[model samples]
Target: MLEHGAAPPSSEPPTAPDPVPSPGFVGRLARRKPVELLVAESGRGEGGAALRRTLTMWQLTTISIGATLGTGIFVVLGEATPLAGPAVAVSFVLAGLTALFSALSYAELAGSIPVSGSSYSYAYATMGELVAWICGWCLVLEYGISVAAVAVGWGEYLDELLHGTFGVTLPGAVSAPLGEGGYVNLPALAVIVLAMVFLMGGAKESARINTAMVAIKIMTLLLFCGIGFFGIQAGNYAPLAPLGAGGVSAAAATLFFSYIGFDAASTAGEEARNPQRDLPRAIMLSLLIVTVLYCVVALVAVGAMPWRDFAGTDAALARIMEDVTGLGLWSVVLAAGAVVAIASVVFAVLYGQTRILFAMSRDGLVPPVFAKVNERTGTPRANTVLVAAFCGLLAATVPLGELANATSIGTLFAFALVNVAVVLLRYTRPGMNRTFRVRFFPLTPLLGFGFCLWMMASLPAVTWAVFSAWMAAGLALYFLYGVRHSRLAVAVAVAGRD
Candidate 1:
């Protein structure tokens, strides 16, 4: 029966390879995946492996706190307070409420969906691929440009810190970008590298660092309040509304930058230990903490000094502390605190960008390579490096103000879209399990959308032009590649035939 040790064959047949599906016209373009599918997709690491869920509520909250509490405070107060006068405190409260509306909507979506990509994923789950693309594109601007902007701000504060403490400074040859009078922004680029290294260690370690930094930021504000309160002249607040209601509105819009990262907590939904319960709680808690801190600081700042005096000054809080106590040392320490706060913002924002890109990559909207997570680090190493490189280049090249306006517009646009997604999802998937439903439903989401739109409309025309160009470019890319190769497009094509 057998010659030369040959054995008898089994009665099994060889398997055929799987076929690649085609893309259908209308259906493929508008394809929407179920939320459950997205939930599963969010957890898959490199090559569809699983990611470690290690972030707790505290970590998530700190992520929001760390990102929201930024150098914007150190800068915006000096600039915005002059416009709103002592009523800048009220402006801070109003601005915070605007973020709160969207924050509530975000809390609901993040809890229910528990995916990355923030509003982009929310739009995909609720709206369609096209809207989701727009949201994702805007997020690329929001997260990417904001990092560069914050880095520039950080660079300035770093200069202030070094000059104040060490009596030394970085030379312009290494500190400024081309158009701004320097070869490159060394400090900004260096900070990006530092953040990249920390993130490479993975999310848990970053959280630990962020928590400590957030604490310092809050404590520094507390110290300012504790000292500045004793100097409150009460008379300083006599003309609280000197700039009138218009001024309050204007200042509120300006102050929105300080409240930018409430939704940052939701971006980490996948890594959150309790996505539903903790994500919502963290979002709300961060908003509450930041709002309280801003209001108290604004009140104390204006009360300690005439609101007019705050205008046109750098390190306003530190200067105020010096004015209150006549101690040059406290001013330096406060300036140093500002440097720390802005660095946390950079870290948190960069963290948010990588996760969003990871989500987009998982959907086949971008290169799948970005979806690859390091098995050892439990992080997306390639994606993190790419983001760092992109941001570092921008930080080293672009000036701060040019980078800042576009971010606010992009952020507000995404917030409005997210608010819309929540409303639409409530109607589309009534039966979907929601761990945290927005309290007032339609009223809240609609108002959130309106508020975001109002602020967006208030931004400069050049900002809109830049954003429009970016979106147009995104549309071109989507049509050229995103449509033909999208996983959902393939699914729709296969399902239609079936």
Candidate 2:
């Protein structure tokens, strides 16, 4: 007979203890070093057959600024200003702060472990094989789709310049991509191809072209900002926070995506003269410069036009200039600047993405062929071609807004992960030689993490869904191929034997 309160046990089997340790904030970070080992496995060492270290600190900073300053300021500002009003200025500040946290973390990690793969390599070194694979997948979406989205933006501005300067308009079928009643985005594809050619030639050539384009873009933006400030009317400031705090925060999250390219500076670690010192300097410097530029641009944009009128407008900066100057001349100049700027962004982003793939392939996380550098050019020719083809297809076909949102979600997710990695690394490897550290350690990273999470939450529900789906696919691939092929996993097994 059973005791009064006693009952028969249910048929469910006893639960198994968890296989992986519960990743507390600290415990999770302890995993960063192993991730670094994974990154090192793919290297031919710093002085190997890869492209020689040729980039100066100034070039790296310029590439970062050039990559980040394009579509976000010139185009997204108009869209976000309407949503947040004059508070868009505050939004830029918030986004910059958030970016600063991550940039600081990147500087420290990059200094200790200067490599070319960016966050994916960082994740591999700090997290594990699986996390590294997922990070790489996320980066593909971030950089790949961004290249395409930026290219489409270039097409719009190119059409505007052509029409304004010569009274000639390319047919919609030729100027726009399909579904917009266009046959192909000829200019967009052409830009991608040109970038590929430049990349395949060599890093020095690419850097020279990028430097020139960056100078042009910066000059145009400064000119616009200078002129627009004087044209500012106080009436535009009516209802400063039109959408209120919530809207401003939301806009900051979206606009933060505009700041994504600054990390590209760190990706050129292997090519920096003194990566440990210069990488951090370049990363922080570029972020600082771009933030100031963004703040000024946002201020002038809101001052020049009412927030309500900017919604759903494609090229708001050009539109604002046309409104203020009334001369088609300024519009043409702005349009030309937009075209050059967005094209430069595509070149920088695509180059970064291909290099990441090259590193991963060299590590055996992906096919080895991607790591194959052309001995003559010292570029990952196969990877560049494949990436360019995919980007071109997307630019020639897909809608820009969908691609932009997807890219933003991927970027924010990668950023959030990096901040978390920073906090984890602090306790796990306190004695690791860090050249540049985030000022307040746990607090700064925590703030950065919170801001990133906030931005992620602000994204459209559909964007989240898409991101989730992409991650799921990435996990499946990791299990199916990356896990078995990973160089780090093999190293771990060998260490166990020894």
Candidate 3:
């Protein structure tokens, strides 16, 4: 028997580590987060839970396609066609080329970086905190406003569906936004609410629903092309480029909104099962598929209808289907499909915005509440609810054209930063492992950056004004709050003190 006094002593349990300290104000803006650390933190949150990696490569591609295909072909085609005449097909091509260059850059960085912040995370790793914050702010404008813009477009198709199926349409007072002949847009608000409910469930569930909706959208557009081909007249093609080259450039800038979602998969990096390999494939594949479909549909649509007739047209695709087949049944079919299509856009884009905010919050740039993940659902529920409320209000009041242009400028700016980030990362981290790399090294990324600037310059002056105001607000917030709270800055300070 052992003596009681001779028993071995136990070790004291380790105490929890101290919370990171905040940094000083000056020069904190230029601090860069290490890429290795960012990668390590992928699915984790400062709020104490991990994001579930439930998305496969297939689901990722669907999210990208779902976010993109409908916004242009169903809703905004009418708006763009009148600006470029029959040569609107050329606008689609031009926009596709811009997207392609950017897509390659995105592919490399997504494979290398693989975080929920997308370009914002890339900039943080390669550039500095201030540039990354600017990129993230631009993303807020891009994804958030596009959701509202798409919701407003969805309301247009809902009106068409109502009239076709039941011979009743919502009155302007309830269906149109304020200052656009209506007091508020209830239908737009409804769609946002519906998407929010699905999002609250989980990302995997949403992706399943989106994939189904994307299939319906594609088949519907193809059906329209089949029937509308008979309505084409060669005379409709005569006045190509009625507004000339300047007009084409403008139309391309507007149409860039159509390609906005091709990068949606990049935002899902943390939620992807194998982000390094899958993210690059998902982005490039989705962009290629969408670009082909967009060009085909735009060519078919303009061939079937006169460009001038596109002006002031709501539910233009359904109107074209009805005219082509001389039956309400086809219009009903197209309208129903559009309802599904535009809803998917709202769903995917809203998901992207929430993820971006979650990333920022974890970095201590925004409030920690945004980084909080629900224990059961593996989602930032509060973030989703708050973003939905904001986007819903915007949908209920803002006009669609204004929302769309504002979105395009913000997207172009963020994309340009992403291109720059790629070149910078290559120079600094030459030995870092990369699953995907841009073909021409500096040339590819440089061209991508140039194309982004070209498109931004082509947007109207009013859009630039809106963008400048938004950037000013973002910078002010970053300096006042982000500077004081940044985790990287805090780490630097802690290291210095040690």
Candidate 4:
């Protein structure tokens, strides 16, 4: 459940308004307070006390990589290419830039807060309870739906691998759960269940699995790029921006979904070693690596096949390779690799959703049970089970395209909020310490917000309607339950007695 409420009003009304502070001063103020909060929180011995700082920089980098480079690259390119032609490459760069701006803002907050729940926690401590609740609500959509959608895509790729490798085909009903032929997606459900078991084992084990999967996926993509580069044709570059600037921008907006995983790194701040230094490095490094890979993959994919042919195809990459290489054997290998890649993505994302819920529960923003860690496993067992069940249902029932638009829209909203929070925190608290600060202060964060809004506007009208309804439900929950239950509210009451 989500929590919500307005911050309590001051005991006395102000006689005069304070002057608006300069952006730089505001930035410094915002930067310092979160660090103080984190230090205080760390000393207090809360939940996650048993969790060790076991994640190395390499492991952290891979977690970011594994989380970000999943179905979006394999699935979205086919849809985006038709929108922008070869200029889809340009769209990738544009989306990367938008993400980079927001990523910097996140680094600053993660450094200061060093807490979980990513932007949700940052908003609570800096912006006020109401805004924090909204941010957390937006994140629920971003993390939860993304896991479902990606898991469903994973199921499709798994089926592709089976058909390609074994020459044995499962019936449509058995292969696809609630798909066009009305069969339930058993593979997706199975994958989610398996991932849940691993996640319940604790952070160290999960990080190890993520690191290995990231390596495998990265190698597979590099192999594809290496092979496809040979097949590149100059003619593919003709009519580069076939749909013009509008189409390119639309594609860029969609591509923003591919960049969603970088912030997952920030969500692990409490578990990070020297979070103030490592979190920023991890976020920026992961973004840089993925941006380069995305560009290469888009270039190779377009050069190998006609952009028009990719639209609406689920197995777009394998088809392109098959046609280009005329080697069924190589396509089989590629399909198998994609299945592993997408599965890893689903695992990483679902883990992130569970963790975010855990953080909220600890703050009394949601049900307390959500924060309960399994003593033996050191994992948030209750939250993991709940999240996995919901994600599994969606993966089995919903169509991928139906959910993709909503996922992108939700994420853009969260990203925009995070950027704005960075600016707000800067103005609200100035004396705090910060290990990392976003460059150019207000200007960078402002541009990041503007870009996210522009992308949000590009979503279809139906997506907007769905987002509005979800937000309304969240607001209702906040007012009905969360505001009354919040720890911050209780703290205020105690202070009044003193």
Rank candidates, TM-score, best first: 1, 3, 4, 2
lDDT of each: 0.85, 0.76, 0.85, 0.76
- Over 1-498, each residue of candidate 2 has an lDDT whose tens digit, in order, gives 001111234233344212232345334222233534433443342124575578888988887887888877777876677668888989999878878887877777777667777888777665755676777888889888888888887877887888989988988887787678888888888889999998888777898999899889988999888878877989888788987898888787767777889988867776677777788888888999999988888889888888788888877777778778887688888888888888899889988888778777776778877777776777778889999999999888776665567877788777777787777667755656576777766877787788778777777888888888878887787667766676645544565567
What TM-score would candidate 4 get against the native?
0.88
Candidate 1 lDDT score relative to the true structure:
0.85
lDDT of 3 by residue, 1-498 (tens): 001111123232333223232355435666788887888788887567888899999999999998888857776787898899999889988988888889888888898889999999999887788999999999999998888888988898899789988999899999998789999999999999999999888888888988999999989888988888888888999778999998887888778767888999999999999998898899988988888888777788888889899998856777778888888788789889889989989988999999999999999999998898887888888989999999999999877575567888898898999999989887876766678878767888899899888878777898888889889999999988988898887777777789
Q: Candidate 2, TM-score vs. the true structure?
A: 0.88
Alpha-carbon RMSD, candidate 3: 9.5
What candidate 3 gets wrong by more than 4 Å, as runs, is 1-26, 82-87, 177-183, 233-250, 306-316, 397-404
Query: Which segments of candidate 1 are over 4 A away from where they belong?
Result: 1-26
Give candidate 1's TM-score.
0.93
Query: Cα deviation of 113 in candidate 2 (Å)?
Result: 1.7
Model 3 TM-score (2 dp): 0.89
Error of 1 at 282 (Å): 0.5
lDDT of 4 by residue, 325-356 (tens): 88887778877788888888878888778867
Per-candidate TM-score against the hidden true structure:
0.93, 0.88, 0.89, 0.88
RMSD of candidate 1 to the true fold? 10.3
**Ten-residue region with minimum lDDT total, candidate 2:** 1-10
Candidate 1, 24-60: lDDT as tens digits = 5654555566676788677786585556789999999
